[model samples]
Target: MMFRRTAFTVGLLALASSMYSHAEKVEWSQGSGQSDGIVVSDGANNNARTAYLSISSAISVPAIKKTQEEVSTLKRELAEVQRNAEEMKRQLSTQQNQAASGLKDSSANLSKEIDDLKRENQSLKSALDDVKRQQSQTASSGSSNSSNVSREMDGLKRSVEELSRENDKLSSSNDRLSQRLNDMDRSLSSLESKVK
Candidate 1:
């Protein structure tokens, strides 16, 4: 009889230990309360009800505190993300403004360059026209047949041809520069669109 009582006591101890281990987990009670409560029970006769109430009280407050702490941490993370996004937007706006200002400055400079080239081209044309008029007047005065005058006339013709070639070269250069300006204008427009 004593051995049987000892075995029974050991089995009860094992069952009680297993119950406590399982009940160590906190469960949230579905109710409108400040702290979510827990309910624990030992699978036994009379003492089970008493054990459940005691464990429930012990576990409820800590579980609710943990949930609140997690919520606070999530709120902080969300605020940080919003701040970072605002900073990125400000930086992008600054960069776009700088790019637009630079493009405008470049366009102004190109206009000035084109105006200068046009003035130089007109000056060259005026000089060439004056030289041709002087040659025509010399040709009309056919009084002397000296070798020196022939050589001088030949030299003047050569000068005229040289000037003509130089003018052609300048005109070609101006055309190329105009084409380059057009290309730059297109590039600026494309960049502006991408920034927008």
Candidate 2:
């Protein structure tokens, strides 16, 4: 009985293998020395190679499109950044020009102020020289005036001394006149007595 069972199992396995082999069909054509073939299989059996190729392409198509969109967005952003940089450069140039103009005006004002200061300094020097010259002239004139005052003082002192001597002479003359009057009165009185 065991031998019969083993033979039955072997027959079944052989039949299933034959059916599996028949289900796969391979047809080939020869072109010169090269060969091309078509491989067909049962529908129930999935082909890993074909499935992988189809799935990978489906995934890759969308991924490539997404990559292109991302690149375009990046490019636009880069262009905007470049434009902003250009605008900033222009603004900076304008500011620099304004600063230069302001500096030039300030320099001109400072130079004019310096010229004015130089003129004022020269005028002050001229006035100082005139003052010095006037002071010297005044000093010389003061010396002459001092000499005149000294001479006037000396003359006045001499006049005062002469007046003092004249006063003494007048006093002596007055005393002599009084004495003569008194002697005349006495003589007259004696004559009167004799006559009597």
In terms of lDDT, the best-performing candidate is 1
Cand. 1 TM to true fold: 0.63
The clash tally of candidate 1 reads 0
Give the TM-score of each candidate.
Answer: 0.63, 0.47
Query: Which candidate number maximizes TM-score?
Result: 1
Cα error, candidate 2, residue 71 (Å)? 0.5
Pairs clashing in candidate 1? none
Total clashing pairs for each candidate? 0, 0
For model 1 the local lDDT of residue 163 reads: 81
* Candidate 1 ranges beyond 4 A from true positions: 1-60
Please report how far candidate 1 places residue 18 from its true position, in Å.
29
Question: Clashes in model 2: which pairs?
Answer: none
Candidate 1 residue-wise lDDT, 21-47, digit = tens: 645343434333433323444433323
